[model samples]
Target: MGKMLTVTTMFLIQMIITFETSGLYAMAPILSNNFGINHSSIILVNIGFALAGICAPFFGVASEKYGKKKFIIIGVSTFLIGSIITSYANGATLFLVGRSIIGLGYYNLSGLLLAYLGDIVAYSNRGKIYGIIRAASGIGILLSPLTSTYLISNFSLKVYYLIIAFITAIILLLSFFIPKVEKRSSYKISTVDIILIFRNRDGRLFLFLNFSMGTFLVLYFSYIAVHLEAFFNLSALNIGKVLTYSAFGTLSGIFIAGILSDRIGKLKLTKIYYLILIASIFLINIVNIHFIWIITFIMSLSFDGGWTIIQTISSEIIPEERGVFMSLVFFVVSLSLILFYIIGPVVYSYGGFLYTTVLSGFFIIISYILFLKFAKNNTEKFN
Candidate 1:
């Protein structure tokens, strides 16, 4: 019962964070019109989480020594405050500030959530719970579009954001119920200690895989909506509906990856996902909207499923220093987001969506090669 509560709490909390994260994208068209900003500027707003990730390694080290639950409290509190600020923002500047703070708070919880799971759940059975918890995470994005449409259409953009605040507030209150966990590591550490994550052989492979595959995080997302609007003339409601349908892919991906990862082998299944993601990216073409939707669905499923497996293996790579390692992994993930946001728009602007997909496909190809050659076995012998 106790473990169930923790999993449920973490599951719900992850869903909320992804809600806030994906909501900005779902609500982008409205935000652009209301604020008089372009797609690029709207997307740039998400850089906030990447910015906050800079501090994550330090927090990771602290959590290992001090406690995860308290930092979790602090993180959720920040998210709540940011959500309220977003709900009440009067203009583009204030709105950006509010949303930026939400990103800053996002990684504090996101990076730690996995590590927190590592603390209570042993490796042998971790996949079962990871599937449930992580699959639940996809639900946030699945509904963000529909919910954003409802709130903005019926109430106002302010209400749309405030609903997020209200939900977050409830989550903040429930956060207190998280059972206390004793410190996981006794060693003193600093931000520099994260370098250890790179020292091991598996750690090096993880970093490579993270970078190659990490770009997938924002690769298509940076301009998918803009492309849809420009090319297909889809309205916000239609786009939201489309993305909602696509998010089901994430649900399926998480479930299958979670259940099968333990039995089949994490790295092996990850390879298949990587291939699916690559093929899906290659199959992306602007000629047909239905084709695009199918590709997007495939991408969503493979990305979430494969990445979950990668993160699952990551927790075991440096068990004693998982906090530091996860922070480092997230830090790389932040870099990946930064890379796409910075490079994606430029490629899309000059080259169009085709060029952007090609670039992303090339990145994954490199990642796949590195994983196959270097990580010959599931677990690299790390000393």
Candidate 2:
């Protein structure tokens, strides 16, 4: 009975994260146009979210000391408030602040959702369960673009954000329904422990892979809409269609990678995921054919699918430190994402579309080689 309730709560939390992120992404281009800004500035929507993720370690420690249930409820409520503020934002600064607050809420969801899963499930079945939770996230990704695009076309951005705010409110309400979860163990969070986490060879390797893959995802997602607008001369409505298709591809990858990881082992599957992702980015750069959405969908499948695998693998790297390690995983990923925000637009400015895309691919190749070299032989330590 206890286990069943835990699974249900985790699944609901996954849904909340998925819906919030999808709505934000769907609103990205609209926010850009309304604010009179470049795509780079628009990319900061994600940056805000990533920045929130950067703070996950601090929050994780707080969760341990204060209580996971308390932090989660507070995070969800705060997110709802931020969503309301974002709906009314008039300038970039106001919009960004609001978005950053939303990011804080999302970090709680995204950073802790899987760790929570890890806490409740057995190690042998962890990969498959993680995959299921992430795949569930794709449901939000699938719907948000479609819904946001429709709202923007017919109603107003204010209305769209209002709906999101309401959804966030619902999430907070649902959070209350979660039975109190007692901490099984605790740790004193200190500066030195934080340093040890980063300096350890195994820990550093996991952090690097987490951040690098995160950067790669942000670069493509942040730019793809703008790329379509500039290159294909597509409207926001049309671009949403392409994004929706891409979301479907991501779903396919999420489920397949999750199943594969259960059978083949994360270490072995990771190499394949890395290579395929590198190739996919190159494919995005070189492909010039007119079937716009097709190419976009394929790229989404490859990149997001690959990302799902990396995420699952990283979760298993330091199981004893699930809260701390997950926090670091999210934090480093968020930091790299901020770097990508700057890197993507600056590189796109000089190199244009194709060159910028190819550059991101090169980064993946470098990181892939490094992870392969540093990864341990057995999963015993992680367990």
Candidate 3:
């Protein structure tokens, strides 16, 4: 019962974190109006979050040395505070400060949580567990836009932040009840440990793959809402409704991939997922406004599917260093966001959405090739 409570509490944390992350995208336009900022400035929220995540590797190492619970507590508390600050921010500087804090807290909490799971769960069942956890997290992404839209439409956007802050506080309290796990090792992280990660072929490939996927997904998500409003003239509520399809797709993909990968193999499923991902992005360029939801759904499904598989693979590669490995993966992902926010708008302005979409797909194509060449036969061994 205690174990179950821990998992349930973590699941709720995942949901709230995911919701807060996705909610920023949904609130972009409203934020722009509220703070009187431009597109670039609005994207700073994402950039700020990514910048903070640069500390993930360090946080991961610290968690291994100190323990996961302390970091989880710090993460939850920091996120709650950040959300409160963001909810009441009246200027761009304050908003960015709040976002940066949220980013820092998010990376610490999430990285440690994955490490915690790696310590407790067996490798054989990791795929299915990841699927379940991600599926739960997907609910947040699924509901974020709709909930944000409703809140913004009926009440005010600030209400969304307050609600997340309140729930996160509750989750923090529940976190104290998580049963402690034995630390895997007492060895402190060093330069050798960091270097060894890249020395492994699988680790290097996975990091690069994560970087590519992060770039592709961020580019798509960072612009999709704005694109809908600009190209299709959709209202905020309608945009939220359309975005909901992506969430549905994400949920379906992660749940199905989770189960199937355990049977058919995570690598094999990833190959198919990449193909679908590529096709979906290309289709988005040509699809009519009415069909946007379907394309976006396919995109979300394929993206989430591939993401889950890779994460499972990362956990298996260096089971002993699972925390650091996951942290590195996310570190690259965060870097991608920083890079994209800086460059994505320029690409969109110069070449339009078609070019930007194609560019995003192109990165995935490279990732697919890398996966086939290196990870095709890489399968997890059960301990």
Among these predictions, the greatest TM-score belongs to 3
TM-score of each: 0.94, 0.91, 0.96
Give the per-residue lDDT digits (tens) of candidate 1, residues 326-366.
Answer: 87787777788877777776776777777877887888888
Tens digits of per-residue lDDT for model 2 on 296-364?
776766666667767776777666667778888888878888888777778777776676677777778
Go through the candidates in order and give the C-alpha RMSD of each one to the true structure.
2.3, 2.4, 1.7
Which pairs clash inside model 2?
Answer: none
What TM-score quantifies how close candidate 3 is to the native fold? 0.96
Error in Å for residue 229 of model 2: 0.9
After TM-score superposition, what is the CA distance of residue 374 in candidate 3 from its true location, in Å?
A: 2.4
**Residue 343 in model 1: lDDT:** 76
What pairs collide in candidate 1?
Answer: none
| lDDT value, candidate 2, whole model | 0.73
Model 2 residue runs over 4 Å out of place are 1-5, 24-26, 45-47, 184-186, 374-376, 379-383
lDDT measured at residue 381 in model 3 versus the true structure, 0 to 100: 44
Q: Which ten residues in a row have the lowest lDDT in candidate 2?
A: 374-383
Candidate 3 yields a Cα-based lDDT of 0.83
Candidate 2: residue 206 lDDT (0-100): 76
Worst 10-residue lDDT window for candidate 1 reads 374-383
Q: Which tens-of-lDDT digit does each residue in 117-229 have in candidate 3?
A: 87888777778777877887789999999898889779875787899899998999998899777654575878887998889988898899999988886778877887787
